[model samples]
Target chain A: MKVRSHRAGKLLKGLWLALVLAFLYIPIIVMIALSFNASVSRAAWTGFTLDWYVKLFKSKQIMAALNVTITVAVIATVVSTVLGTLGAIGMHAMSTGMANLLINVSYLPMTTPDIVTGVSLMLMFIFVKVPLGKWTMIMAHIAFDTPYVLFSVMPKLRQMNPNLYEAALDLGCHPAKALYKVIIPEIMPGIVTGALLAFTMSLDDFVISYFTSNTDQNLAMIVYSAARRGVEPTMYALSTLMFIVVLGLLLIVNRRNGLEDIA
Target chain B: MKRSWYAAPYGVWMVLFTVVPLLFVLYYAFTDQSGAFTVNNFVKIASPMYGLVLWDSLRLAFFCTLLCLLIGYPTAYFLASRDFSNAQTLVVLILVPMWMNFLLRTYAMMTLFENNGVINTLLESLGLERIQMIGTEGAVLVGMVYNFLPFMVLPVYTVLKKMDYSVIEAAEDLGASPIRVVSRVVLPMSIPGVVSGITMVFMPAVTTFAISRMLSSGMIYLVGDMIEDYFIAMNNRNVGSTISLVMLVLIILSIGLLRKVDPDNTGGGLW
Candidate 1:
């Protein structure tokens, strides 16, 4: 009886594990499988077809949207990467309540809901007479994306040995040169990861882009407008494309961060 | 010690973007561009629609948070204690879904749960043809739980992994059953994780409009939905900002209340 009960318990545990993982992945799996469904209509799975892939390349709007998204994401990533690194470095010199306050405020954008962030930032930008275009979108993204970059780098910045910089200084290196030579090398991982994170945020962001985009700004806005038009048959293609990109990003980040670290 | 020309660029970005936008929020919170320094916007948020919407938002958010806690705790404990060769795979599985736009997920959920979608079709194939899943509170819950699962898992997993196994071993040595050990020992130790998980899920769930809009078929207008209407539909920045200020106050008060759980106030429940 004891042996039977122990076997049953193990079986039950296995059942629970299967059930949970299946529950999490079922939608994603269904979506991926249907991407190959010859029917472009996500409304149903009629047949298997790859014609959507062919048509995906034919749409100029999708291409334009893709261009805007890539351009905007690249710019935002570069800007946020630079400022965030500097901010993290600048923060190391100050060990005060002010630093903590600045850190918290920097993170407010990360915590605040996207709708509020989008609307408020849009209003602020408009009121300030900053024209709402690609630049405004970049500015808005930078406001929020910097926090992620800062969060990624700040702790790593704090952990580095100050003596390395001191040693560089002693060798007659200028402060900027010491920063470039010593500080940069020490925090390379943080910088790379932070930039990747910023890029992800830029690429995936919807709320800010929705509020700030004009006729020609980002892919998220394009997808939104397309969906509003009764689920553009091409939207599923766009979604499938997005899934691949995000999945690729996930794999890359996981390998970089290491499985043990994520666990 | 020499601040370069680059300092000016940093200073300019800070002023033009972060510092100014925040100051703009504060200044707008007080002003009355409805032509005078009046409190009319604050009064407008007191309307029945706003009140109902706020109540709706709170109700849905609480339910979502409760669901997350129930689903997340065991999963977090199991994952945190495991020695898997590919835990990264599992973490990424939970995380990758979040990278897609929220709007896309909401729309995809509609396709799955709608009357003509897979769930019903599957149910019909299985001989239960009378079930309704979409355009209901259940659909809202599904969306919230789906989107916010990672938020709950990440913090709780972080905390649970840090819990000392020796404490549990001590309990076991004292002749406590696994059930008693968990309830009395492990759960209490994970309060910070629980707190953070709840906060992370609750904050966004309460303010989300897209989920409600995409799933609810207009029968339900959450506070988030109401706030969206105020700004986008009615063109009432005054009322929208007022509601934001009120929500901000409520959120701050909630944070203060939760802080009482931490003796030292070292960090939030999640941190």
Candidate 2:
């Protein structure tokens, strides 16, 4: 009786998880499905159509917004990855207390509300006030993204064998040579993961970009302004494309590492 | 020859950019128009309208946190408890939405909730009429849960994963029933994650201007909306700065209290 019931419980648990997974995914599936539906009305499927996707290519404003978002994300990610990795290495080299303090201070910006971050950055711009534009957006992204990259890289840094660097130095290698040849190679995985995270984060941002962004628009901000009247077909097309890009990138990274998920 | 040249450019960048700007925001938050530092800006929080904004913030945060807990807790437990090799893929799949554009996600939801949208049309077909799910306070809550569910789930899963299965095995061997074991042991062990998830969900729900705007159609004024209106639309920076300070204080206090209550939160482990 006990064994039978245990088996039953296990079956129940599996079913429950399956159901939960379905619930988690169905909404996104609905969005993707509707984006492809030939019929405009989600109420009834009229037929199959690629016009929505095609229409997206014809829109200049959307193309501009897409360009802006991509550029900002690319710049922000590259800058943050370098700063953050170095910051992580610096923390690793430091004593424990200072390292902890620096790490904590660096991550504080991430915890604050986007509104606070946006307004604060905007005010900062206004005070000394450079023009709020692409650069300001990059500035804000770096401010927050550094900590994320640091945290991602720190564990891998800690995991690395210190003697490799020491051995290189003992062999008469320069400090730069030791760092570039030894320390950086060990921490590449962490750095890459952090860069990916930063890229997605900068791409998905709204409130900060909304405030600090000059007359330009990112994908998210454009969707916001367009959704004001009604969701444009192009918004669906663009989001679907972005969703595909995100999935494809993650899959590529996962496949390269041969890991199903980041642990 | 320069220690400053290449040793820490990010530090220089942050100092010139982030740190300097942050201090200026703090200065603005404290000072009045005449350059005199006063608590009057902070005192403006006592106004009834701002008071309502605070209340609205708390209500939204509390409910959104609760809703996420209701959905995410079960989902997380299921994910954590599973031993199947394929489960990690499903977990990752669930989290993929976390990377999607916030505005696009909101737009997708708007399609489902709008008057001529999916949910209503289905309801009408089912002989239900005028459900009023959109443009109400409920729509805002739905929007929030839709966005923040993964945030809550991920943290809770972290906790659930850390919990020792041996505790459950021991409890069962001691003759406690399954439900009893879960309530008495599993639930207790997950409090730290619960606190973290609640704060993660609550902070955004309270501060979010986008969902409230997109779903509620500006008819449902949230505290975040009010703050935006003051600073951006109305140019009432004095009052806006005051409210932001007040909110920062409240968040700090709440987080402190939450951390204090959760005995295991002191561990510097990130989920």
Candidate 3:
């Protein structure tokens, strides 16, 4: 009787998990399916067609936003990866008190509300008379993205052997060369993870970009505006494409290192 | 070490951007139209209209956090108790939806709950009453739970997965019933994950403007939406800054309370 009840409990648990999974994926699947429907109404499905996908490509505004988003993500990723990797190394070498202070400084941005970060940065830009545009957006992205990168790289730094850099110096390498050749290769995994994370964040951001951006619109900002006016069919197509791309990237990353370790 | 000097560039950048910008918000929050120091902006929050909005925001966020915990804890436990390979696959499945754009995900919920949308149409075809689901408080709550559920699941799952199975087995050997084992062994040890999940879910839910705006068509006025409207629609920086400061204080207080509950701070990261 006990064994039978155990089996029943296991079955019930399995059913509950399936229900949760269905809840998570069902709405997303419906949206993706509606993207291909010929009619604009989300309630009724017309015949399937690739017309929305074709229109998505042809829309000049979406194309512009996509271009700006990619550019900003790439620039922010590169800049934050370099700065954050260096900052991690520097913090690793500092005294405990100094390192703790800097770490707290880094944590402030991550914990702050997005709206606060958005408005405060907007206020500062206006105060300094820096025109809000693509550049301001990129600057804000770097500011937020760098902290995440630092957090990522710091764990890897803590795990490294402290004598590795000194050994390289003893082997007749210059300090800069030793950093580039020895220490960097050791922490390359963290740097790569940090870069990818920063890229994804910059691409997905809307709130901060909404306030900091002027005439230049990123993909998220465009989507937000469209959602406000009732989302266009072309947005469904764009989101479907983005979903596939991100899923592919994540799968590739997961294969190399366990997904749990990334965070 | 000399390498410590490498942080100089980032230090300067943080001071200029991070420190200065927050200080600017503080200045704006406390000053008047002509830049004279004043408490009027802070006093505005005590007004009935603004106070109600703040209360509603906290109430809704608390409910969303509670719901996420209720749903996520069981889901996490089931996954963690599974065989290793199966558990890993399920974790990936949970994470897949999270990679999609946040705005798009909320928009999908909007499409589902619209008056003439898929759900209502289905209800009508089944000879059921089609209730107004969109532009309702319930819709906003649903949106928050949907968007932030994964954040709750991941942290709790990580904690549960790391828990030693021997401890559970020991409880079973002690003649404890299944319920007793769970309550005495699993629940106590999982408090850190629960605390982390609460903060992760509650923080975003309270500060979210996009989900509330999309779900309720601006009918819901959470603190976040109010702040966004003040800055963007009304173009009132002073009032917006004041509201933002109030939000910051509330968030800090909640985190402090949660920290007291989570003394050891075991589940600190998203992973």
- Could you give candidate 1's per-residue lDDT for residues A7-89 as a string of tens digits? 67656655654666776667666666665777654546788777776677788888887888888888988998898888778
Q: On a 0 to 1 DockQ scale, where is model 2?
A: 0.51
Name the regions of candidate 1 deviating beyond 4 angstroms.
A1-7, A40-44, A259-263, B2-16, B32-35, B83-88, B130-132, B263-271
Point out the higher-scoring one by lDDT: 2 or 3: 3
TM-score order of candidates, best first? 3, 2, 1
TM-score of chain A of each: 0.90, 0.90, 0.95
lDDT (C-alpha) at residue A262 in model 2: 38
Candidate 1: give the clashing pairs.
A38-A47, A38-A48, A38-A49, B196-B270
Tens digits of per-residue lDDT, candidate 1, B1-271, equal: 7323333344456556665665555556666765356677777667886788798889989999999888877777766654444554555566566666677677677667867666877887788874676568889888888888777877777777778888887997999986898899988888877777887888889888778877777667787777677766786666677777677667767767776775554322322
Residues A26-131 of candidate 2: C-alpha lDDT, one tens digit per residue: 6677788887888777787777778998888778888898888889999999999998888778767876786666656676676778888788788778777588
lDDT of 3 by residue, B1-271 (tens): 4999877777767667688899999999999878899999988878999999999999999999999999999998888885335777788888788778789899888878988888998999999998898789999999899999988888888888899999998998989998998899998888899899998889988999999999888899899999888888998889999999889889999999999998778973473
Task: Report the candidate with higher lDDT, 1 versus 3.
Answer: 3
Identify the runs in model 3 with alpha carbons over 4 angstroms from their true place: B83-85
State in Å the error of residue B260, model 3: 0.2
The model with the greatest lDDT is: 3
Proportion of native contacts in model 3? 0.65
Which CAPRI tier for candidate 2?
A: medium
**Residues B1-271 of candidate 2: C-alpha lDDT, one tens digit per residue:** 2212232665666666556666766787788877678778767778897788789879988989998888888778878875456767766877777767667777788888888888888899999894766689888888888888878877778788878899888998999997898799988888888888888888888888888889978878887887788777887666777777678778888988889868668321233
Better of 1 and 3 by DockQ: 3
